[model samples]
Target: MLDDTLKSQLKAYLEKVTQPFEIVASLDDGAKSQELHGLLTDIASLSDKISLNLYGQDSRRPSFALNRPDQDMGIVFAGIPMGHEFTSLVLALLQVGGHPPKVTDEVIEQIKGLDDALHFETYYSLSCQNCPDVVQALNLMAVLNPNVSHVAIDGALFQDEVEERQVMSVPSIYLNGQLFDQGRMSLEQILAKVDTGAARREAAKLNDKPSFDVLVVGGGPAGASAAIYAARKGIRTGVAAERFGGQVMDTMAIENFISVPHTEGPKMAAALEEHVKEYEVDIMNLQRAVKLVPATQPGGEHEVQLESGASLKSKTLILATGARWREMNVPGEADYRNKGVAYCPHCDGPLFKGKRVAVIGGGNSGVEAAIDLAGIVGRVTLIEFMDEMRADAVLQKKLKSLPNVDIILGARTTEVNGDGTRVNGLTFEERASGEIKRLDLEGIFVQIGLIPNTEWLRGSLVEMSERGEIITDAHGTTSVPGIFAAGDVTTVPYKQIIIAMGEGSKAALGAFDHLIRS
Candidate 1:
């Protein structure tokens, strides 16, 4: 629509303005470096449209600030925006442009009123894939409210620092000097913690540790449900965990969970914890169990040593150690995992809405994810190493029915292709055909399998399955007396949260049985 003269003038202006912009590249052309650089270069060359570019390449600090050049913003391209990163970029761009983005006014007021400074240092790995959002959120806090700063340290990049800080888990955040929140924390919850830290400490100091007849390990649905049912039975119980939510903490959103049509992982975890808190039980949060030893006598008591060096003696022990997602273990896969690689479709599916994605696996989880993603993403590529799907016929049919879903059978994933910042595509080879195909996708959801969190109990009192699942009796009793097992870590067929909770309740009752018999 513009005249030739005007178009030339605009081109000249763009050329002049882009001369001063700096391009920060982490890798050589080996990655999508050139493509990303070109994209960023083009975006940065836009007019003063207040485009906020929140850079997520900082491998240290839970979150940090990146100020644009004197020229007001152009286009906002968040490199690692999923997980906490997306939230952070949105908030950062808002603050840098001096215009608040689309959020409730009440939320804005709460953020503005915060005056005290709180810093959250979270140790996370790119492979975690769920940790980026938490980091992004903290970054947003740094922008919206001046009182808080978040720094995310890449667990792999900052191995020495993580070891020094004693951070063994992803999304392990320290508020100020003391540990504040770990795992996925909501903005409201984070604000409350910082606002009520002193008050909470003072109040907790006054309250005495509640006595319990049984001590349950883990606090996912299984542990939380167990605690609640035990309280209902008038039994004193205590639930301990490194992180209160357990494996479910990494979930983005849970749609398959019964009763609730849809629920976020953090919300579900908070609700469960709140329910247990209503009971008279000692809730030990942010504590890890180091070792479990048998009672000194025939059936006196079991001693649980904690990572904090604190010990808890209980008549009964419930091992609810759950399972952790397996990593791809391929090059560039770990580097760009959360950046583009993900494990749980339930947790990260919403972000990939309308985008091309590939689900890696042929089992029930993979087929379910492919079917689920077909509804959200533009295209769903289901890759299986076997000749056919390993999932139920119903799910396989559902997955195949989706027009956008593509099935690549007998294909094994060889490498996850990325541009160093986010996943661009994946490479796989057909076992029977021996033909290799590279898929270009915006995201990849890995549903290979889960590894049980029962390695620590190898030489101890419990037996584990060939798949690393803990063996438990009908009542949740383990091989050792006074010891019980529950949840996904147990040899149960189902790994649902509701099932875990039900088993946890059964384990609590079984522990009570043993305690009374003793």
Candidate 2:
């Protein structure tokens, strides 16, 4: 299944294996099984430390386990780990073969100390950009802790399990036999959930941090840029974020970043974090900022409070909290979220295969989602609130050419209909005819847009727009002195990743200029 070039690359990577491991497969005589057999054969041929075996006794057919010859490590791939999961497979091999993982010693120790007999099964899609992180993290944990076992399953290939579990989303994790979490999660986040005392320990550590000269409140492109710029000035810089990468982590394809022709969200986010780490920035990921307290006296530090009960003070604070996916407030929308309502087409599109689904909104995201869904789903109904689609001409043309797609303009989504468990259909009002219509579908994909993450600033000293966006001047400085805002969280017109980064850098410069003047 791999080309000659890929073979050469795999051989180079496999040479780093310091110990011997076996790829034991229990594949039946199916198409995917044969394909997986070929992939394993190619991989095993590249490394003398690697050995391949078939016809194992695993209950899940077309699956394999990576383990030492003497022991079962309990790290299993229940489906063919290709596409986005190919990287997970490679990492599993390297780690199982005794190559050290690229994780902090502290985190590695935490994983080793876990004594719970936890078994994790994650349902994932091949096209999902968010699944690899969850799969690889669990794989590493299983490799580290003998009490932990993880099974990475491809949802599309295992339709029976997907349907039985009602998994409408990718990266749906189950602990033991119950649902644990859905969507993207970091290794730290997973550890926090499993390790009970991890949160209190993290909070205590965060609370002990000293005051920073320039403090950034987000970890998106803008926040990363700001942190880097501030740290370069030989100042103490710190970044506290709900999760590094912000909304950019949910993004699939980013083509218009200038010079970089193609990149995924996770890859770009990783690069941003790596760049910031090159400086003296102290990054605190998975930290949510809930309140902002302005400095009472001039030339004093402002305080930013986190949901974890940790507070950070800074001379100048840069707010780059960015935005989140806007949701329809209609009835049943919230109730059915992840039950049948989804946001990313690339992540959840596979579960809706051979079923009817609807895409809400007619902007670029909505149109692109419809076009992508048309290939996998049985039918796609695109509904828009405006009379005309806001998508570009090229996308509109492609969407119109798809035979399995239908577009409805001037329609407002009224209510989402579901049978208490999952979405069944939706009701919309036609603007032109004043007629209420219902779409009978299995899923609804919301692709309207984003809303700034500045609700915590309300009633505070910070000036805000009617849309709840933080108001900022040309310098990225907010209404309050010594408090600057940038990225989508501010009053910036465009919300592109590149624009956010530039604005972040500008905000850092503005903060520095203010510090010098003070």
Candidate 3:
């Protein structure tokens, strides 16, 4: 199941194992069972301390009982740990064998204080990169306390259970038979939900109306940068974001941030929040701005109303609401969102490496994705609705130079075809001949244009472009005297991380200048 190189690496990791651990694998008479059995056998052979036991599947099909003797650990895997979740398996084995959990003392205390029984059923897919983190965190939590038992379910293997639970996405977590969390979640976030009373208390404290000198909306790279800059000026800066990471959290590998050679989206997003936390910036996460009220006069304060019924007033305002990727909205697109049809090439492309994939859209992002995928994947098919490509000459040339890439023009994607579990292929119609065509591919990356998140500014004093993007001049000053805008939600020429960060800094300086003048 694993290559020689991987075996060698795993051997080194297993060599450090000090405590004894056994992997009890229970498999049924299924095709995937054989594959999983072989994988577990290979892993068990890597270390002397590790042992593998095979058993017939019971009510819990394809289950794994880790450390059979120490059943009190309450650690179990109800799915084959492969793909991105392989790391979770490796870490679990080590943790069960006496390796301490990576969680902080505060988190440990929170887990220890839990009196009620917490049973977590986390559904995940092998290809989902974000799923492993949540799975590992829950596994670690289970190891920390016997009351907290977790069953990591592979959504692919347990399709019936997935359908019964209406699990539309990966990392769908259920606590005590109720949906607990979804998508990428931090350990602290999970703990917050464990104690609902404490979570409500914390939310109430944050909901208390807070005022600031410079209030930045959205918590993407731009908003975080703006908050940092404003806070550095010794002002009461605050950031209101539905999620701190914004679109950046959806991104995968980022290479064009200037100094940094390579980093993932979640990593950079965490860094942004951590850097902002270094300052005195008041970060109000999970808070959405429903409406913006501009200052009546030059020296008056602008008010921002949140969906949580809380209000934030500031002398100067920075709008870095960011943008979201436009979806194709075709049949089966939403159903197989994380199953195979993905949007961010940077985040999910590597998962389809060496597999045949398709890229929809002829713009810069689509062309760039095709070029990027051509190197990693076996083949890339670029389909464009228009007759001619709309990408820049340089990017078009680079895309054309890829030998493993094929470009198709005047093709309208009809539907995303999947086989219940994941995407299998796609269908399209020729715009000229009306002939239907199909391509067998594992992944489809949609890199269409981004929709700016400036809809909330409608009817407000802020001037916007025809496309709903905020129109701002140099120094990030908008049409409004005290209000400023930046990032993808603005009419900025380029929507990039570094560019947005620079724009945020400029907007903060512009706010400082306006505060001094008035």
The positional error of residue 348 in candidate 3, measured at the CA in angstroms, is 6.8
Taking the tens digit of each residue's C-alpha lDDT, what string does model 3 give over 1-518? Answer: 88889888888888767788778778888877788888888889898888887863446767887764656566778877876788898888888877777666977888788888888988876766677778888888888888888889887677678657756556788988998877887676677667666556555676575667899999998899899899989988999897888988877679999989998787788799999989988887777788999888768889887765667888999999999988888898998887778776654555565789999999988998898878778999999999999999999999988899999999999999999888889999999999999999988999888999877788788999888999999899999999998899999887899999999999999999988888
The TM-score that candidate 3 achieves is 0.74
Which regions in candidate 3 have their CA more than 4 angstroms from the true location?
A: 1-71, 78-118, 125-127, 140-147, 153-169, 174-182, 187-203, 329-358, 364-381, 390-407, 413-445
Alpha-carbon shift of residue 2 in model 3 (angstroms): 11
After superposition, the stretches of candidate 2 with alpha carbons farther than 4 Å from their true spots are none
lDDT of 1 at 496: 89
lDDT: the better of candidates 1 and 2: 2
Lowest summed lDDT across 10 adjacent residues in model 3 is found at: 344-353
Each model's lDDT comes to: 0.68, 0.94, 0.84
Model 2: lowest-lDDT 10 consecutive positions: 452-461
Best model per TM-score? 2
Clashes by residue pair, model 2 = none
What would the TM-scores of all predictions be? 0.61, 0.99, 0.74
In model 1, the runs with Cα more than 4 Å from the true position are 1-146, 149-183, 186-212, 248-267, 346-356, 375-378, 392-395, 419-421, 433-437
The best-first sequence of candidates by TM-score reads 2, 3, 1
Model 2 Cα lDDT, one tens digit per residue, 257-327: 99999999999999999999999899998899899999999999899988988889999999999999999
